[model samples]
Target: MAHSQTEEESDKMGQFDWFGSIGATPEAVRVLNDQPILFTILLIVLVAIILQCVLLWYIHYATLKPEQKVKKEKKKPAKK
Candidate 1:
């Protein structure tokens, strides 16, 4: 027995355009599809590098001591 699609299913299928509906051009989608593994690796590396830099900056900033101002005492003149 063969199953048939209903009107709603047909309409939903008709409205689907893989690239256009997702807002990406066909060429962009094609490129991503072709190099999915490479893109995934690059994205992971980029995020790791960014996180490392942020953590390093936070550590450095946390270890820093704010400078304190030194107040000098006024010298009084001795009376003869």
Candidate 2:
């Protein structure tokens, strides 16, 4: 029996071939893709900023100024 090469295997190898690249290796690409630590850190940072903005907006526009309201009430009685 003789070994035969198939067109599909040849195409797959060609697709994955990065034979003449400079600076970056397959190991580096594999390591970068496999690790999720950097992604997780970025996600946490984004969530924190979003939460901070939400809290800031709540404090800016949602809270009532009880002291100012009381002062207006006092002045209104004196004016009448």
Write down the TM-score of every candidate. Answer: 0.43, 0.39
Per-residue lDDT for 40 in model 2? 70
How far is each candidate from the true structure, as Cα RMSD in Å?
A: 11.9, 12.2
- Looking at candidate 1, the ten consecutive residues that score lowest on lDDT are 8-17
lDDT of 1 at 17: 37
RMSD of 1: 11.9
lDDT value, residue 16 of candidate 1? 24
Model 2: number of backbone collisions = 0
User: What value does the lDDT take at residue 30 in candidate 1?
Assistant: 54
Model 1: residues with Cα > 4 Å off, grouped in runs: 1-22, 66-80
lDDT by residue for model 1 over 1-80, one digit each (tens)?
65465544334532223655669775565566666776678789999999999999888877777653345889999899
Candidate 2 ranges beyond 4 A from true positions: 1-31, 64-80
lDDT for position 12 in model 2: 46
The superposed Cα distance between candidate 2 and the true structure at residue 39, in angstroms, equals 0.0
